[model samples]
Target: MRETGLLSLEAKKRHARTKIHGYYEGAFKFTRPVRLDDDCLSVYLIHVGGGYVDGDTYGSTITLGEGAELAVTSQASTKVYKTPSKPVEQHTKIHLGADSVLEYFLDPLILYEGARFIQNTTIEMEPDAVFFYSDIITPGWSKDGVNFRYDWVRNKLKVYQNGKLVLFDHLLLEPDDELEGVLQLEGHTHVGSFVLFHPEASREFAEWLYENVFESFPDVRLGISDMEGGGIVIRILGDRTQTIERILSHIHTFARRELLDKGEISWRKY
Candidate 1:
């Protein structure tokens, strides 16, 4: 069976405030949006499955109308079990209108032994819109007690601004082919990535990360660079999930202040 979710949001500029004008929810649901200053809204994504299984296919699309501001997060980590017949697939597309903003921070993703997974993401936004997105990938326990037990996982991302392709990133990990080489995971088990796109993204932001955020996490390996069109890409590798999570969390907090001129986002789970 195929599981799909659709979310469409529009902003209404009436009554001297910006709020959710209209929205539609499909298979995937969301908790009530927590309001914030300056027309910001935060919500948690909800799914009704224990985890993804073999031959499972899931797709979702999120659209933000002009001037809308929204933040989305997953309540819990995602788990992908063994996929013997067909690999589990996930696809997401996001659209941001002019002067809009979206912050999407999904919890860690776990892939068990013998699991096969594939993911594709596409983001289209206007020149003035901003997006802060991040994700972490972790290895699940295996009966053989061998690291890198999962079969394979491939992740691909494409970002477009003003209807023009600017960035394309692809990551393919094959453990059986010896991933400890220089260009591969390099003896790391957990991997995470943070992407920030804004018109003001520059080399200075990358320098700030090196001096402020990256130095705090001495154990994790990180790389930050500026995108061609205008944005930043950060890749992190660590042994523990918490270590990577902490590094990304710090970046998110600092970036929000500098990039969006907003305070910390309240992410209370309870």
Candidate 2:
């Protein structure tokens, strides 16, 4: 069966600040949002079921009205079990209006033996729209405790601004293939990526970000690249999931303090 979720928020200026004028939710569920000092709202995404099974299909659409700013994150990591017949499928589409902001940060994904999963994401933004996204992938357990035993994993991303495509990214990992090659995981068991799209993004900022965020993690092989218009993309490869997460934490701090200018943030999950 196909299950779909929807989320929409409109921004309204009041009390000398921006607030959500209206919002909508569908099949997807989220915890109550909390307002931050910068007028940005934070919300946590919830998966009704604990994990994904065979033939499971999930889709979500998100839209932010003009001037709106929102931050979203997953409550926990996503787990994908064996999919003998069909792979678990997920698709997400996001729309941002002028001067909008969105930060999508999700936990690691756990793929068990024989697991197969596919995910696709597309983003459409108008001018002056800022966006940040990051995710990690981890190998799940197997009978023999070996890593990379899954069937395969595929993730694709596309971003467009003013009806012009600015970025396109695709990733695929198969355990049966050689993962220790120079162009592959390079003996790493975990992988992650961070994407930042903002008008102020520049090579200098990317270098600064590398120095501030990636230099601290010696165990991880990191790379940063520039986008066509103005943005940066970060690639992270690490041996342990914890290390990757630690890098992500630093990246988050950098983003909030430097990019979003909201200072340190806490989900209050504790």
Candidate 3:
């Protein structure tokens, strides 16, 4: 069966007064940021915006309005597994208008042994708008060489604002690459990341995320970097899925409170 999900955020100001717009509208323009529609089951978003199995695939899209600011997140952990037939695939697209801002707090994608999946995200931003995005991929879970085998998980990320290229990142994990190789996973199983944007972006915020978010966890390797549009990206690698999810949640909430002036808008497990 073919299945699809959509989330969108758009806003318009009434002479400088901001008002919420639609739950999901088709091609509209606005001045203030309005949370159009949020996909409640698997993904979470305050102002704006999947699933499983063998021989099946799912996709989603999120669009932002000009001058609107919004954040998107996943409600629960994303599980990617391998089956005898076909591997799972997920596709995401983000469109930002001029002066718009977006942040995504994606929970870790747990890849099971023998599982093969491909994930990609494309971000198109306006010239004056700020955009920040990231994705982290890790090797499959394995114990003995003869029992469990995982390989060939591909991930790609691209950012373009005002038609200008900002960031392009690609990663591929294979079973033969000396899992212990330098500059790779470094013996970590779980991987995650955080992307943020806005004018308040600074070196101070990056340092704060490292000390306050990553430093609190033990046995986790983390790093923070800058984006082209006054934003920051954080990467973390660990063995436990729960710990990695916790860090992602914290960073999501922190950015919402600090940048968007919004409170913690949570998701319910249904």
Candidate 4:
């Protein structure tokens, strides 16, 4: 059976406080918006089955009104169970109004042996809006203790601002007979990426992030580059999931404090 989920969010300012309005969800569930601060709203996405199965399909849409601030995340890692016949699919779309802020950060995706999964995410924002997004992929345990057991994984991400395409990222990994010679994983079991798009983004921010990472995490390999529309693009590869997760958390925390001038966000689920 195919399962579908939908969500929408809007924010309005009332008496000097940002209040969330026009919120909706179906199939996929979320807890009531937790006010991290007077300006920030946090919501966590929940999966009904606890994991994705064969023939499962899910979609979510989010919109932020002008000057609204919202962050969307998942309660736990997305688990992709074995699916020998069919692949599970997920799609997400997000829209941001002028001066709005959005942060879409989620836990890693764990793929079991013989699992197949596809995901697509698109974001459209006004020229002055601020956005941050990230995700990770890690190989799950297998009985044979062999690496790269997943059949295939594909992910695509696109971002647009002021009706102009600003960034496009695509990733595909399929282990087969020639997997040994390929550099897909580069002898690593986990891979991750993060992106930040805002008017304040500059080369100095990217440089600072790149330099700071080397001092703390020497084992993880990281690459940082500038996006077309004044933001930072980061690619990370590591052997341990915890190492990558920690690195991402550090970056996200820094961005929130420096860019938004907000304090650390605490989630009860974690």
lDDT of each: 0.81, 0.81, 0.59, 0.81
Where model 2 places Cα greater than 4 Å from the true spot, the runs are 4-27, 36-38
* lDDT for each residue of candidate 4 in 105-170, tens digit (9 for 90 to 100): 888999998889999999899988899888999889999898888888999988888888888888
- Cα TM-score per model: 0.91, 0.91, 0.71, 0.92
Candidate 3 CA-lDDT value: 0.59
The root-mean-square deviation over C-alpha atoms between each candidate and the true structure, in angstroms, is 2.2, 2.3, 6.3, 2.1
Error of 3 at 154 (Å): 0.8
Residue 13, candidate 2: Cα error in Å is 5.5
In candidate 2 the C-alpha lDDT for residue 158 amounts to: 92
Q: Between candidates 1 and 3, which one is better according to lDDT?
A: 1
Write model 3 residue lDDT over 108-182, tens digit each, in one string.
Answer: 665667677777888887666655454545444556633226546777777775677776767676666476456
Per residue, candidate 2 scores C-alpha lDDT tens digits across 137-251 of 8899888988988889999989999999989989899875578678998888888999988887888888888888746776568989987666788989887888887888788
- Per-residue error (Å), model 4, residue 132: 1.0
lDDT by residue (tens digit), candidate 1, 1-270: 535444454544345455654343444566677775555677777766788888877777777777777888988988889999999888888888888888999999899988899999999999899899999988898877778877888999899998898888888877865687687888888899999998888888778876787478765688888976568999998888888888898999888888888788768876
Q: Once superposed on the true structure, which residue ranges of model 3 sit more than 4 Å away at CA?
A: 1-55, 83-87, 127-148
**Per-residue lDDT value at 145 in model 2:** 81
